[model samples]
Target: MARFCLPRDLYHGKGALAELKNLKGKKAMICVGGGSMKRFGFLQKAEEYLKEAGFEVQLYEGIEPDPSVETVMKGAAAMEAFQPDWIIAMGGGSPIDAAKAMWIKYE
Candidate 1:
């Protein structure tokens, strides 16, 4: 048998990042890949939004395309050390995939 799980809540559209303010947490770790998000200013906006939400935000940037085992382990170690209540995967799919692995290792 197989089971699938999904996030309890999903927010989107223009201003979706602002919804972070409604989340109940003190710390949040943002995982991002490459430079697009940074170049485009989404990364900064995310940090600001999280801060406005009262979270101490930490960033795990530079997750590469097709992420490596080493990267995943390093991200997991960072997560272990930071012990954030929320892990926000930003940017593209690579960061999100890396964050998922890191979350599993963190648990």
Candidate 2:
């Protein structure tokens, strides 16, 4: 049998960052690739938001486009080191999807 897991809270739409205020966590690991987040300036905003929510944010960036299996391993290793309670992956679909797989590997 296959198993599935869902987030306890899934908040979308506008200004979802406000929801972070309710998150209970001491550390957060943000996974990403390239400059899209930084180019749009969402990266800094997200980092600050997590910090404001009392989470120590550590970024695992440069995951790269298409993100090879090796990249996933490296990201997972970084995540292991960060030991974050919350995994925040922001970027295009590829990185998010890859990070999700990496997240599973971390667990």
Candidate 3:
């Protein structure tokens, strides 16, 4: 037998990232891919929103396309160290997918 768990909330669409400000938690870890999100200021925005939510945020950047097993392990380690109450992945599919795998290991 196997068990699976998914986050209870998901936000999407333009300005949806602002929804981070509504999350209730003491700490949050953000997982990202590449520099585009940073170059475009989305990363900073996420940080701001998370902070506004009163969460101490940590970032794990540069999860590559199709992320390797090593990357997943590194992310999981970071999560363990940070002990975040929540995890947020911002960017394209790679970072989000990697975060999902990392979250499983984190739990």
lDDT leader: 3
lDDT tens digits by residue: candidate 3, 8-103: 766778979888888898999999999998999999999999898899999999999999999999999999999999899988889989999999
Per-residue lDDT over 1-107 for candidate 2, one digit per residue giving the tens place of the 0 to 100 score: 97858456545557976667677989998888998888988888888888898999888888788888998998899889889899887777677877788888899
Better of 1 and 2 by lDDT: 1
Top candidate (TM-score):
3
Q: What is the number of residue pairs that collide in model 3?
A: 0
User: lDDT of each structure?
Assistant: 0.88, 0.82, 0.92
Each candidate structure's count of clashing pairs:
0, 0, 0
Tens digits of per-residue lDDT, candidate 1, 1-107, equal 96546456545679888888787889999999998989999889888888988999999999999999999999999999999999998877798889888888887
* Residue pairs clashing, model 2: none
Candidate 2: where is the Cα deviation over 4 Å?
6-12
As for lDDT, the candidate ahead, 1 or 3, is 3
TM-score of each: 0.89, 0.86, 0.94
Q: Which stretches of candidate 1 lie above 4 Å from their native place?
A: 1-10
In angstroms, the error of model 2 at 63 is 2.0
| lDDT of the structure predicted as candidate 1 | 0.88
